[model samples]
Target: MPPRPPVPRLAGDGKGEGTVLQVRRLRGGDAGAYQALRLAGLRLHPDAFGSSWEEEADRPLATTAEALEANYVAGCERDGALIGIAGLRRATSVKTRHRGVIWGIYVDPAARGLGVGERLIAAVIEQARGQVEDLLLTVSAHNATAISLYRRFGFEDYGLDHRSLKIGDGYVDELLMKLDLRPA
Candidate 1:
């Protein structure tokens, strides 16, 4: 197997000056923190995330723990508070092994603008390098900040899912984006 990718160390502005936030592969023990951050993201940015907090709030800890243990990178306090998480799950069929979907990307609002999201995405890209030839994700069309971030990370828009999600009494469009990482 290829070596695990290098972990990203991002700096945060929490300690009066700056402190390094550790980004590492999440384990089963991090399920609660992972769920907490994810739920917070959904609550704060409902249009930006695919899953709703209402839907996920009742998920069992075991399910969250399995997800964290299976395929997730978490950014957290060195002392043990999980502030961000991103996941890459490989497609099931053999022909789809070269592709992976990015999901559950969330960073605590308190940790925003501190490079946590960048570190999380970098970790995702690094992990996808060998296993996947392409990666895909969807973002709310109105999420300009996220779109800009994805663009900076080399993703390109391929299409849009019109009114993909029902929000309030209406709907929101989803911008489909892909990043190709195959060796040339």
Candidate 2:
């Protein structure tokens, strides 16, 4: 298969003071920045994700770079810094090829509420179009903000996991959501 062309950079309005938000697919070269942002999220919001900070923080750069190339990871940059990221995990198996996952979406705390998350998700969906028939994600049941954002993008809650993620001594239930990319 030929290489996938680089996704063109998308420009969007950032909140206040002439901030310009640049959203684009992150590449292997972006490992350092991506790791920083991702580790921050994992450390700051342990219950929000299935992956733990301890597990990913120590991962080698080569592995992170390899993972970046294996998946569609979108990064939102503001003033030359990676402030937000979202990833599309497309399936490899033929039976599940019609499905993809929206994963590892995180926006720096300071950049939240300025539509950074929304743009990251939009970029993921744009890349998923024509590539998958459906996109799915599991958000922590307690994360109303993230859940609402997913709903805004047309994701419907299909089920709930009673206790899916165990973080430290607590458990977090997850809401299973899906968005159909096909017309009914």
Candidate 3:
């Protein structure tokens, strides 16, 4: 098949916003782009992620492919380029099977105000609803933007994890947040 054409960035949404996004499941073939974007996030903002660029940088591409297939990962696209990702990793033990962790929520800097993060998050939430009773994530304590966005989705801060990340000379604290999906 001739390569599929790029989705025009301004063609949808009917509002001339200059960005049209398609948030969907990412498969193994998407590993390269996923890894690139993920590594960029880790390198650009070291405190935001628990993993370091050095740790993931040396892994083979196949490792990334395996991860894409193993987890519930959603990718957002604009103009045919993968721009954002979010993942939902369910608990393996039966006792904790009713919950999942929301991880790796990142949007390219260019896509920040265009709702890319929320789209990735919403897709994860949609996929997670019937599968888990609660969703949890950790955000850097100093990241007000992410905390606010998660709050808008009804996530509540449950606790603080001090010294969550030690990047260079300083420690970064993390805020533990959760969104209950249980019917109350």
| Candidate 1 residue-wise lDDT, 48-147, digit = tens | 7778989999999999888777775655553467887888887989888889888878877777777778788888888888889889999989889888
Q: After superposition, how far is residue 64 of candidate 2 from its true place, in Å?
A: 0.8
List lDDT for all candidates, in order.
Answer: 0.80, 0.87, 0.86
User: In every candidate, how many clashes are there?
Assistant: 0, 0, 0
TM-score of every candidate relative to the true structure: 0.86, 0.89, 0.90
**Cα lDDT of model 2 by residue, 41-67, tens digit:** 999998888899989988999999999
- Candidate 1's C-alpha runs over 4 A off are 1-18
Model 3 lowest lDDT segment of ten: 1-10
> What tens digits encode model 3's per-residue C-alpha lDDT throughout 1-184?
2232222222234365456789899999999999999999999999999898999999999999998898889999998999999999999899999999999888999778787877887889889888998899999999998897888777889999999889989999999998887755
What lDDT is reached at residue 108 by model 1? 78
lDDT of 1 at 153: 77
* Count of backbone collisions in candidate 3: 0
Report the alpha-carbon TM-score of model 2 versus the true structure. 0.89
